[model samples]
Target: MDIGTSVITPSESAEDTLPSMFWGLDPIYGVFAKLYIKDILELKKSQPVPGVFFYKTHPITKVDILGTIVQKRERERFFSFGVDDGTGVISCLWWKKQRAMENVRLASSPFGLNVLEQLNRINQLENSNSQLELGDVVQVRGRLRDYRDQREINSTSVSKVVDPVFTAQIARMLELPYLYRNFYDKTFQIQMDSSDPNQQGEPTLSLQRKIKQFLTQNGVKNFYQQELEAIDSLVCIAEQNCVSLCLHHPSQTSQDPPSSACVSKQIHELFQQAVCALQEEGIIFQKVAAHTELYLVTDAEKELHKVTRKIVQDDSTRPKYVDKGCPFHHIVSCVRHSYSAGVSEAAVQRVLDRLECDSEIVSTMDRHYTVS
Candidate 1:
């Protein structure tokens, strides 16, 4: 059956009203050789709504897949690659100029050296129909499409896999049936009631409360968005709080948890939603630095801490006077006078250590300092 005819473009009503099942990250189904792709191709396509389509089996549109690029072919307007994940090989194509520019931008970033190298390799490859060389592992996120009786992916992103072992581990976890079974079970469901007065007034209040409680209870006054979104980090926090995550079959409960791929996806979605809800309510706030979101609690104490930290960090980088060098006490005094919060000597010392480690400051004789 033709799968393209059954594809659903999300409606405006669905986009605006449909509550996300989990918070921080939107759910993207995983695909490998043995799973959904093979089954989806075998199903009969049926259009259920004006823009949406279904099949005999559930239709999965957006997906995350990993494979090694065995062949690459570039045309005048598009680039295509064949990705094989042992179980199956799929064709992936990137068609838009904007997408190409985004790839370039990502490659230009400081942490994108590997990406740059990959791009360079692509450039160096001869017109022998290779944009990427054979055996280059990659992770793809895209919409699945079928054209002329062939299944292919219209890629949104195609990233070079920096850590193949870690990617393999994730792929293995996603292949487990128990993950999907647990996900469908009611035990993992987020409680939401349309009938309750509080829920009616503010539908996301309970979710916000849970997120706030999780942050506060964990003593996470400040954290990077990635740190909070990381599966291992979240699992560590959950373990510390004696919270149980239902990521496995109901019958087989174990203290040593399985890979957190499934649990992380759910938690990430919930965390994302809760953070957005809290931000909208002005309960918490985020600041972007070095292209990463840093969340901070919006309380007086935490606000003061932020100010103090900034003051010390800033002072450490400032050029020292020629006549009198910048000393540790000088930083404390400046911070104390700059803000009513009264910066402590310990805070200044801590900042010094951080700056020194970062190579932003150099310590001289007699406890004096100069910016490096």
Candidate 2:
């Protein structure tokens, strides 16, 4: 499949394709969700694609979801369970191949006894403690399939969630790309403002504008506290020097200007809040060094770092091949080969996801990819 052309449609607006009613159905696939059972059921189905549902206009399939197992049932051929991730509940089914394995074991008996040992090893691995249990938080990777006209997951892999809080953090991290993509849309902007009052704060907006202005004037991609402090001082000086002709004007008051300490404190607070807001919007990022945080603008520079790190890691593990006509170049391979310090598989996957979403890469087949 030409993923760049088929799976991703960055130029088209989702609203244009969405149904008139909020509950309209659509076919969506290959997306993940971290939502409650109620929210999952509320998702609209797609008319064009039968048996497919959408969440926030994004198609979901082969999802990586985190939830707590609420119930479990084991049958002769399969085990099924219900998972509730706070929003709603969904059933997950894992089919057993024990009977097939037994047949294989019996057939292998004619061969060396070593074959039976191998069969036992496979059985041990299959019956490991990875099995689902009621009340256990778990992460599941699976396809959103249907059985008996009801939505369920045909799970591919299911593992116990080591830390519920950490799993929630991972869910939020995974959702960032989608949120960032829609952030600038007018409808999304309104939705965000309605949902979070802080998003529309006048002070925060003013601070962000000022930061942009300062960065532009300095021609720098980032600014540390020292630079921010210098700018703050200049602004205070300009404010103090302003002439007030009207007696009724607040600036005409004989009261003394704010002290340097007060000015510094206020500016510090403003800058901190502005940086946080920008980071949440995926516009900037921060690094902590020696108990101080340094802010940097994110864009091409960040992209270069991510790509370069991946290439370097791949070079160490695999032979370097020309960018074009490299059969081994694959998204999963790149992620698996990545060896950056402090980087996780989730982070590498996010980079690949973003690149694919932006049409910078195309999928040739499952796990296989090429740059566009």
Candidate 3:
């Protein structure tokens, strides 16, 4: 056997020495073996020694491919090139010197790069192949060289080549706007320069509030337009309280007492006090369902009969009406049955205790009632 091909054996150590970091610094043999565009920026201060860069080529493999093109020109070219393996993609370029290699010439025509090109024939090849439809995946091997003129490192030359299977599904991933949002991971962000705190030029609190309110109103309107259609039935519309309540008769929807006296009398006696309690705490009762025709039927009807009958019967003390339905109603119903039997003061504690009851009826009750 040739001396060079003789049995492999460990040689005696002549001197202890650290292995060259060159392999560790190899572009294809990254220490971590994978990185993001932002992560590569961290290595700016300590870049690996210049050498060949071999990676799968795709749009995302190259950092700022489109941005670089856009910055150079007003718009990006039809295609952007990238290179990577399962590990990660690195942006690449082909310089004039490195592109002269014979291997670089082969990839030119298949990729539609012109052979007569003067700059880098290899670049022409890569560019020709780089015009991939959205989801095509490819593997490329090349050199990572520093462009002294450009003050940046980029891949050069052309070596191994493998075209990944192309699929239309990859087109979705090419959505530029969506990718930008994901890359930033923020719905919206803004920057403001600091100004002198003592300066009279600062915006006032009232001005800020007005601006915020305007923004909020517009945002709410836009949000409603997008989402309201799906929930129109569940949604209730209202204008500022300019409308009068018209209570509908429970037994007969067509006919309502013209006086509005009976309804008002019962409702006032029952819920007036409780309603006042809620109002004192700053809970504003707003009208619900600006144009709803159906109104609620309160227990005031029963309570009134009992009270008036007791008065005639000479009962000494009038027992308060506590056993009644919960005092919530559709606006129309509340107005129609204006007289409601509210929880009596004597039985207020019991009523409060039962408030926690999870009756399905009460749970589904109209949320449009006026609260005390």
On TM-score, the candidate that comes out on top is: 2
Candidate 3, residue 158: Cα displacement in angstroms equals 8.2
**Candidate 3 lDDT, 157-252, residue by residue in tens:** 233323243222222223333444333222221122233331121222222233234334444312221132233221111100001112222342
Model 1, residue 293: distance off in Å is 48
Show the lowest summed lDDT stretch of 10 residues, model 1: 1-10
When summed lDDT is taken over every stretch of 10 residues in candidate 2, the lowest stretch is 184-193
Each candidate: what lDDT?
0.51, 0.53, 0.29
How many clashes does the backbone of model 3 have? 20
Q: Rank the candidates by TM-score, best first.
A: 2, 1, 3
Error of 3 at 22 (Å): 7.6
Q: What lDDT score is found at residue 302 in candidate 3?
A: 35
The candidate maximizing lDDT is: 2
Question: What are the root-mean-square deviations of the candidates from the true structure over C-alphas?
Answer: 20.4, 18.4, 32.5
How many clashes in candidate 2? Answer: 13
